[model samples]
Target: LACAFMVMSGYCELTSVSSFDAGSFSSKIVTLESIQIFTTHEWLPAKPTLYFLCQGGNRTGLPDVKKVDFLYTFNGDESWQPLTELPERKCKRCGLYEEDQIKSDDVFDEWELCPGDFVDGKYVHFKEKEFNATFACPLCKPLEEGSPSSASKNEATAHGMNVALVIVISALVSIVVISGAAVGYKYWQKKKREQEQARFLKLFEDGDDIEDELSLGNTL
Candidate 1:
């Protein structure tokens, strides 16, 4: 589709293309109308990535789009027309640039699983032995596959096991210490009782000799 847009705003005006020679191009004469810009933020590689939608039907005839080239012209200067070729990767999951800076203004943003695929499209890219592309909304990115949820669960389980083991070991150590203290205290108390009985027996024997001597003196 041929479209024209005002350089100031990002809106594109719809234009029709007719058959013509290779050098000569035909365009429908339509008045320019001002429209709102439709700018979207896509997660590309560290380098800039281009996006395109397929315009072919299913399984029968594949689209003849061999490669995509992005053409850019500056706001006022039409002299410099830059063309860039799209770079292909083994998998879209590789070389993804993570967005950590300021967030976008839109509350609901679509996330494509692959790098080059557009949002809300069904023809997701896949690899034979490598990871495949999966699309997710902005809200769903946090809970997507290989996220922190599984790791967090594993950490929690490990923490709980450690806590339980610590509690059990503490209880066993306290029981052993308290039992040893009780046995030592009982032994000390038994030795004290035996020493007191021995002292009483010694005093009784000494007093019996004095009583016998006083009886003999009274008889004399």
Candidate 2:
């Protein structure tokens, strides 16, 4: 299996802005512009075949590097070669590695490749003991500003949603309060009616006892 370690240092700057697909803002092409190897990591004197590897097991082989400490530039022919497509919001694990015949491939360096890391559509990654490389993507750009009307529309929509949620919550609370008040009033009325009935029954019982006493006194 191929492997790589992370150690990066480079300078990147944006020089121009280019239009990209509206449907796929995150997707942008990555191309290799140049690379200079510091150490080939070989035991014998031999040319090293290098390749780029990224997430999802994507690989692209580069031209064989003939010498160390020498800068190799790619012409327009290789400029069109797509190394990978990177997303603006997410980073992909990518690296350079040497192809090996007897064992697993040796890693030069690996790092999280992110479109956001590019300044002015270009990024340079350098590992002190391994290699220094430059990658370019003409279409990669910073977040573009939308029209004022669009921003206003989005804000208005969000405000309207908040208002609707408040209205719904208020309506529910009012309904619960009204229902509770109605139940309390009904309970009060029932209690009052029961008290009135109890008072009337007591008066009737007292009248019957008084009549019985008067009848008994008259008999005596």
Candidate 3:
């Protein structure tokens, strides 16, 4: 018995506008830029628990801002977490903040995401004065040395595999088609031979009957 495997696909995405220069307050604000969406299928056999690991930063190394706040929203859920865990290591100089100055404490304490706020579907949207972003787990790919780069490579590899799979599928289909044509040709040849044999037998019987008729007439 052959055991079949089902393809259970899933993915997460992150979107942000171009990086903002938060200056010395870089750690205080994530350069708000673009928003992203995440989607995935939930298999019946194994349901996975989802977790969010979020991060932010400023591109400039200038003196960080005095204080910054961060806001977040999630799909189908009202109100966002004031503060979420950073995706990367914490900077020793900034304490709770990641390098570039986006501090975890300021966001949770100062940010306000009152009513009628939602991130929209399997995604966590981070919004701030200078920083706006969104994240999801399943759709998140890994970066070359980190989650971001690895994620991109994974997508490229998956695409290549899909292309190879299509080629293999086409080859198998061609083989099946060729085999069917050969079988049909053999069947046609067998039927033609049978018809020829029948025709020859009918002619032989007619000739015998004619000879019998001649003999009878002569005797008469």
Candidate 4:
């Protein structure tokens, strides 16, 4: 079967190849426009991690995709929601990761899960795993899953730190700018005063010469 799939970033034509047997039947994706797909199946509460790979006949873990004429939702939800992207851990869920779907504008962002994947700084590089664990919430996985209240607090604290740092730096910068402007203004005033004094002295000397000439003329 051949169909078009609208993913988060764009649209692609997806073809499925099915092989039938007496006991088992399997379907394989024969063609897709892009080499990779992103999925949030890993971070789902208790389910086993099915990251990025779209499997099953129903395409069960996929999200809602909309085209001009039709709309499709994964798992029958009115809207498709991609969970935060996470990598498959060794079942301990210690080092789960979340990656955003790549945007055309964000080409350079990268999280190199495999060796030899050379992603530059423009690609989003996943930071060190922010520790997640189930606390008060029963819906949370055995390890860290979902944005719990505690996680929210942690994010808020980090944000607060960032804001305070920016404020302090801004204040320091304002002080430096004001001080420099004052120094420049004072220097300009001093130079102007010196120039006026020199002009006055020249005028006074010229007047003295004129008086001397007049006195000499009178004496003659």
Candidate 5:
């Protein structure tokens, strides 16, 4: 009877983090997509209320769920609420529980919830005596070591290349401007020298003409 119950209840063994590939985990938003309870672990005429507990008794209730052995599906609406936010690089001690009027809450199952547990954006947690559940975290991902630092290094290298290109362009522009200024100055000096030589020759020719005129006057 126990074996038959375990089989019918979809029993799942506890999985460890070491079973997954080695990588750093990232934060993700978890959603309780669907759940079905095979046994409520309650007596007759029991009013079972489901809630999630994590981070040392922080409770979040699913007020709408009350039935057992019926698959409850959540639509993409207000009824489909986010369960919890898992931290990056840390596994949360979490579990599902039922509220009890006579005593402490009844635990369905307790496990260390890690981002790596989700395969292809979903994870199924099942306990033989309690319940079977499906959780969704579409954005959960495992990051390799040095990934963020590698991105920062790439950005820094690109910035350095941009600065070096700007410096080279500025140096080229300065060289062109200085060469043009030097050429213009040399041209102006050549023109001034030519003008001065022409003026001196004109002065010498005027003196020669005056001397020739004085000589003719003396002869006459």
Candidate 6:
């Protein structure tokens, strides 16, 4: 029996900007350095989660991002948790201040994002590499040597096979072209020899009278 399948596509994009402003309690605008819009497609079967990819330093009144915070939701329902977590990770005197009282300045130059696998939420964002947690993400399995991510390794393998196939096909084409050129050169030489022989025979078929007349004139 013949089976058929249908495919559908969906897309979503998230951009990291230098700043975001929410005015009148609703509309928001993200400001960045001159990139109009960056887009990524989300497949129907695999809905890729949109991460903010926020690094640098926290402009929001959150804990020093280097110390604790990583993925932060600024305006929506996860707003309070994002703001509170920052202050909690501060020094005792620093923690006592209310979240609103905290200054929104860049601090701690060496904040580092924990190595994380993005697909399937296997590793929590900003979770330490040597963390004391179970490997829950489908994409975060320990590969032996070459494979990077579960999905990334498969992609790399497929691309490598494609490149190998192209090289093989190109080599075959080059061989065929060189062989064709050699055969063509032999055919051209044979045709030139045949034309010369035909011309020589025509001179004799026209008789030696024309040749004799030319010789007699030269002698006179």
Query: Tens-digit lDDT track for model 3 on 1-220?
Result: 1222222111111111223333322332122122321321232333222222233422221122222332333341223322232223221111121231223222211132211122321233343333334433321222235454345557878999999999999999999999999999999999999999999999999999999999999999
**Residue 197 displacement (Å), model 4:** 0.8
Clashing residue pairs in candidate 6 are 62-86, 63-86, 122-137
Models, CA RMSD each: 20.6, 19.3, 22.9, 19.0, 22.0, 22.9
- Where in model 3 is the C-alpha error above 4 Å? 1-146
Comparison by TM-score, 2 against 4, better one: 2
lDDT of each: 0.36, 0.78, 0.39, 0.36, 0.78, 0.35
**Model 1, TM vs. native:** 0.33
Off by over 4 Å in 4: 1-147
Write down the TM-score of every candidate.
0.33, 0.51, 0.34, 0.33, 0.50, 0.29
Candidate achieving higher TM-score, 3 or 5? 5
Better of 1 and 2 by TM-score: 2
Candidate 2 residues 1-220, lDDT tens each? 1222222111111212223344444458788888899988667677888889997967898874668899988752573367888765566899999987778999999898866557788889999889999888776754434745345546878999999999999999999999999999999999999999999999999999999999999999
TM-score of 3: 0.34
Model 4 clash tally, residue pairs:
11
Candidate 6 lDDT, tens digit per residue, 50-160?
222133333333222222123222232334222111111121111111121124421221222222322342333122331121113222223334434435657878899
Q: Runs in model 6 with CA error above 4 Å?
A: 1-148, 207-220
Residue 148 lDDT in model 6? 48
The alpha-carbon deviation from the true structure for residue 11 of candidate 6, after best TM-score superposition, in angstroms, is 53
> Per the 3 Å backbone cut-off, how many clashing residue pairs does candidate 5 have?
0
Candidate 2: segments with Cα more than 4 A from true spot: 1-27, 142-220
lDDT of 4 by residue, 1-220 (tens): 1322345223322222222341122211111111122322233243222212221212212222211123222321223222222222211111222333442111112222211111221112232222111111111223243435336546867999999999999999999999999999999999999999999999999999999999999999
Q: Cα miss at 155, model 2 (Å)? A: 26
